[model samples]
Target: MDALGFSENLRVLRKNKGFTQKDLSDKIGVALSTVAMWETGSRRPGYKTAQRVADTLDVSIDKLLQDEALSGGEYLSENELYSRITPKTRNANHDLLEIREVLRTRPEMKMLFSVSKGATKSDIERAVAIIEALKKDRG
Candidate 1:
């Protein structure tokens, strides 16, 4: 949505990776002018080309198109956001899926899930106590 931001982001990422426009072009198999146009906001690349660019830069496509106006707090690239949103598990067991669904709907539960990373039995017991205290307070 923000073409200027995208252009600036591309330029910054390219430079950070020590890639000249020509070098990026060679890596992505695009003409040098195409990379120049993308950086100048004269043109936008297609989705496939954008993916290639992201791969080359080791960034997410969403990062390339990040809009500051729509973001809150620390800026997370698309990939980062996706990773945070998705539950990491070896298998999609029914219980895990159900837990994920509940977390999706319950902000407090989600917060506890994030805060209780590598949770010990005691940590879970403490969290349950805190949640029960809050519930009693509400009652």
Candidate 2:
């Protein structure tokens, strides 16, 4: 892990959030010198302090530590995607879970099908058509 890389990312995020070193230190209850040291890569913060900084900056600890990974847009290979997905998708899964919850509560739009019994052939076909239409719109 590159300490300088992490430091740069932390600095960028802090500035983007309009926080001076003193502002960040005050928010996270650290000394301004400590924040300055961390930002300059002269020293690293402890795990707890690092987490506090991340929280105050509204970024994940992994994101703070591995800034390079977050900045690139290269399409990942299968194994790369699998490894990269775990932590990143933990946040995404929370969003997906909320979507699932909302979808569960939503009344069936396909009233033509008896959902209780199971989707009929026409219902499946219609659902597929709806999905294709949505895909087209998105594209």
Candidate 1, residue 135: Cα displacement in angstroms equals 50
lDDT of 1 by residue, 1-139 (tens): 4777778889988998999999999999999999999989899888888889999999977777775422233576767766644354324455788898999999998987898898999989988999899999999
Off by over 4 Å in 2: 67-139
Best by TM-score: 2
Off by over 4 Å in 1: 69-139
Query: So what's the TM-score on candidate 2?
Result: 0.52
Compared to the true structure, candidate 1 yields what TM-score? 0.51
**Per-residue alpha-carbon lDDT of candidate 2 for residues 1-139, written as tens digits (9 for 90 to 100):** 4687778888888888999999999999989999898878899988888899999999977768763533444444657645766776778888988867766676563343345248777878888899899999999
- Each prediction's whole-model lDDT (CA): 0.82, 0.78
Candidate 1 lDDT score relative to the true structure: 0.82
